[model samples]
Target: MRIEGKTFLVTGGASGLGAATVEALVGKGAVVVVADRNSDAGAALRQRYGSAIEFIQADVTSEDSIVKALDLAVGLSGTFSGVVSCAGVAPAERIFGRNGIHGLQSFRAAVDVNLVGTFNVLRVAADRLIKRDRTGGEEENGVIINTASVAAYDGQIGQVAYAASKGGVVALTLPAARELARHSIRVVTIAPGIMETPMLLAMPDEVRASLAATVPFPSRLGKPQEFASLVCHVIENPYLNGEVIRLDGAIRMAAK
Candidate 1:
């Protein structure tokens, strides 16, 4: 799909990877709606990007919230062409550990925000795309990109909830693509490793350095811009459907 003149909705667009994606998309001439729960950050983004971006405080786990975001996107650009779901929560807790058995609420929170949130955005976007009349000669209707994590494949000692939530995202890619094919909407997931998000950046220098060393080549934390670049590439590449691409720098995480 052409980036220029198209519209996209980005969940968690207030900061981190989602913020980078908003920048990239706007640079490419796409109108983007920033959907996030951080009102202050959303206001900040709006101030930075001006009218090129729209900010809507949204929660991806709520269907009503997602619908409002989608509505705002459509209002801005007539209709939106894609969505990049980046809203997620990472909770570190062992199943049985010093903290006692993991709380069911915590586990549910991870799954709800990470896995189910991704699905909520995708489903709502897919429905909207399916209902819209196809533009002549435009073979693709829309793209849905989900954010997973390397933890899905390499769950460490304290990542049971996070890993399971992300794992569900990894598992749903192909099926979503298959079902949505007839509507000309594609689904893809990106699993990033040790990204330099705010959480990681807040760590002590030595701890951050130790984590960066885990990556095999070009040993450093993955940049949010790099992930945004892949998102742009996936948006333009017509045949990259139903795949989960790893943005990790050949890092196979070790159990801690």
Candidate 2:
């Protein structure tokens, strides 16, 4: 499960948590395929990392798109050893909002991207990993790291769709790991609290500070690198499987 000399496919790797992971993995001598929809950012990453990384524009909601991305990973490197699914969207819309009832399309969109999209990548990557030769003494073939949210457990107001999608991710981890055990591929999910990603940075300074004050300790937002560090640990630790690790800074969000 060591990262050195291994290959990984990182979805939504052009920025935020995914970007940090791509950089961290490459720094450890692992070949990374950056799968994202942002061509400009992807190109920037390729330019920054050179041959250590490859950029593939992929839509996680589509099976064909993810399959093609996986194929590109094999073509770029030799085999796929890991996958990190970070492609997700969070839109806050109350079911009974002042504007109107939440749109059904919004709910479906979140679930499709966050939940179904994750499964799409997992199933395809697991299949490819299963076909590969086992490397470690533990017979480990691959690892899957999915991104969830603390909202899955403690969703606040205006997060009905977002919470449901993340809840599904948290719920899927154990069963996925159990089923994929025979193939020696591990599945794990990370439920992160408020983090200092691009999405959060867009908020006004006062708003961001208010959000930071919610964390009991550290009193600041989580950093993307911290999340990336945990991912590295999960990859190197074979026994760590089928579990959801919370990277929140002891923060339990309140209903807004």
Candidate 3:
């Protein structure tokens, strides 16, 4: 699938990995629709890219909200071809802790935002792609990329909710791909480990360094641009479907 001249929708595109992806897509001559809850960041991005970027303040968990963003993307181009679901929340809590126990609402919030939110975008995007009219040489109608975390596999003691939510994302990749294959829509998930996102950046220097040291090689935190680069590759590589690719630098997280 050629990225140039194409239009894509990127959820959580206001910051972190999603922002990097928006930049990469625009740099590659693709128009991008940024769907995020951050209005300030959306304004900044729209200013940065001008007409190349269209931003909609969106809630990934709501189908109506996602539909508006999708409609905006399709409006920008004749048809929107792909979506990268990077909107997620990570909550740390133990099943039984000093706080007595994790709140059910918090657990539900994590799953609702991270897992269900991702599925919402996939389903809505798949529907739109399926209805699109394709031209010759268009082998695939669209691609759906989801964001998962390494915690899904090597969850630490306090990451029960976060891990379970991401674990669900990992579990859904293959099935989603298989179901969407007939529509020529690819589904893939990316599980990143210890990236330098805003949450980690707020930690003390020593703490950040300690986390970086956990990676076997590179010995540094992953960059959002690197993740964006991988996203571009995934979009271009037609064969990479129904797979969860770990973007970790050979790091297997230890139990905390």
Candidate 4:
């Protein structure tokens, strides 16, 4: 579906990949609802984008929260055209670590926020889109874009919980797309490799550089804008659905 004149709800839109996506969508003339728990960042985005974007404090893991966020999207823009599920958490902890056994709480938190949270947003957004009147022939009602990580496929040591969470996201794509097809909604997931997000940037310079060197081409961490660009492309491309597109620079990570 064309982005211009449409509205999209972006979870975790306050920062990182989600922020880039919100900006990209607004730049393309699409109204965006920035659903995130970061009220300060959300307010800043709303102030910067004015009417092009709306900010709603939302917890993606909560059904009531996301439902309200989607309602707000429609109330602000009159309709919901798509959603980009970027709300996630990545906690690196080995099952048996220097401290002790990996905490069950940490594992549950990762899965709850990364995997289940994605589905929470998707179901609510898809429901709204499916209820909308289609613009007629060959017109898609909406699209859902989810975020995974290259670790889902090539998880290194100390990434058990994170990998499991992201792996669930990748596994969810195909079935969701198939089920939503009857309503003209598309579901796709993106598995990004090492990226220049805050989590990676927090690493020491030498460490960061070492990681960047792993990428086969470009030999650098992926940019959030590149991720956002793919999201826009996926939305506009009707034939691209039910797939997990890896945004890594051909890097197959080795087990640490």
The C-alpha stretches of model 3 lying farther than 4 A from their native spots are none
Which regions of candidate 2 fall more than 4 Å away from where they truly are? 136-138
lDDT of 1 at 55: 96
How well does model 3 score by local distance difference test?
0.94
lDDT of 1 by residue, 1-256 (tens): 8999888999999999999999999999999999999999999999999989999999999999999999888767545798999999989999999979999999999999999999999889998888766665888999999999999999999899999999999999999999999888999999999998999999999999999998998799999999999999999999999999999999999999
Q: Which ten residues in a row have the lowest lDDT in candidate 3?
A: 71-80
Better of 3 and 4 by lDDT: 3
TM-score of each: 0.98, 0.98, 0.98, 0.97
lDDT per residue (tens digit) for residues 1-256 in model 4: 7788888999999999999999999999899999999999999999999999988899999999999999988777445688999988889899898999999999999999999999999899888888876664646888999999999999999999999999999999999999999988999999999889988888899999999999999999999999999999999999999999999999999999
The global C-alpha lDDT for each of the candidates, from Candidate 1 onward, is: 0.93, 0.93, 0.94, 0.92
Tens digit of per-residue lDDT, candidate 2, span 24-100: 99989899999999999999999999999999899999999999999888666555698999999989999998998
TM-score of 3: 0.98
Q: Give per-model CA RMSD.
A: 0.9, 1.0, 0.8, 1.0
**Clashing residue pairs, backbone N/CA/C < 3 A, model 1:** none
User: Clashes per prediction?
Assistant: 0, 0, 0, 0
Candidate 2, residue 2: CA error in Å?
0.9
